[model samples]
Target: MKHLLYLFMLALPVVATAQKDSLAGAVQATRPLPLYRPGFALMLSAGSTGGGVAVGYSVSRSVAVRVGANLFNYDGTLKSGKDTDDIQIGFDYTVKLKNADLMVDLYPFKRSGFRLTGGAYYNINTVTFFGKPTKDVKFNDTVFTIDEVGTLDGKANFNKVAPYVGLGFGNPYTRKRLKFMVDIGFFYQQSPLVTFRTTGMLEPSSDQGSVIQKNLEPLKYYPVVNLGLSYKL
Candidate 1:
């Protein structure tokens, strides 16, 4: 009976130690995680602006910044007017979109992916067209050969610095190593400067650049929609 009592006394300390450890673990498990942590991430995206890559840094739970570049180019042919019309023209055109951006994101809610983004883009967007008569063209009552009608070449350029505003979804500081992000926004690029040259009979049309520039006034606000994946680094 004495030995049994000694054994119980010795085992009591070990049992108390085990219970204390178990309680500590339970308290730790129930504790809430931090809302944000600073980190760096890499992102690859595709959207109306084209394909792009960016590097981002989370300054806090509510704010982040990114720097990136995007590019897209298209070359194609366009036909306008009809063969039966006084003039039928075919165009060889190229559209190029290229830009670099510095952006900031603000999150208003804790543990939410929604964010507001504002930024500036170094814009280099252009459209070039070369048009030639596809068939004999009539000027007043006189019909002229394609060679006499000649070709018209023109280019349209936008402002160099554009301001952007938009909203998006994605939080790079989350516990997840990979996250999906999206942005939808618009940037104000101001008016486009149009320039053109004409050869042969089309020389008179060169002065019409102002008219084309006015027609493109609506292009000042460029829309952007991007979908991407971000990997925390």
Candidate 2:
């Protein structure tokens, strides 16, 4: 009987220690992981605005700031059929999309990837066009050569400062070191301003810049669709 009592006392501390250790582990497992910490990240992206790079800083779990720049360029030719004046034309054009941005991101949900973003862009977008007769044409019943029909050279520019709004998925400051992100938004660049000059018989066409401007009114809002990869620094 004395040996039995000694055995129970001897086992009590070991049993209690095991229970305490198990309870500590359970508490640790139930504790939530940290979702946000102050940090910096570098991001690379591509979208309608073009290819871009940015640096971002997390101010908190709910807020972040970023600065970035984007650029894209295209050159192509377009052919047009008879105009109102019955003139067929072909144009060689170049498009430039260049911009820098300052943006803020807001996360409304504590454990969500969704975010709202707002920002301003320093825009330097422009289009240059050179148009000429595609074939021998007539003016006032007089047949004229392509050279005599002349050419129109012009450039279209947009507002320098643009405001943007967007929503996106992914949070770079999360526990993961790397993340995938997507953004969909629009920026207001206002109407395009066109300036042009004409040579030879097409000199009068220079006055038609307003017609070009009016036609481009619908382009005031530029759409953005960006896909990106971000790495926490």
lDDT tens per residue, model 1, 1-233: 99999999999999999999999999998877555757899999999899999999998888899999999998998776676877777989897999999999999998798999999999999989889999887677898999899998899999999999999998877767688999999999999999989898888878878876896688899999999999988
For every candidate, C-alpha RMSD to the true structure in Å: 4.0, 4.9
Question: What C-alpha lDDT do the candidate models reach, one value each?
Answer: 0.90, 0.91
Q: Residue pairs in steric clash, candidate 1?
A: none
lDDT of 2 by residue, 1-233 (tens): 99999999999999999999999999998887568756999999998989999999999889999999999998998876656556787999998999999999999997888999999999999989999998887768989999998999899999999999999999998877789999999999999989989999889777788887886677789999999999998
lDDT of 2 at 210: 89
The C-alpha local distance difference test score for the whole of candidate 1 amounts to 0.90
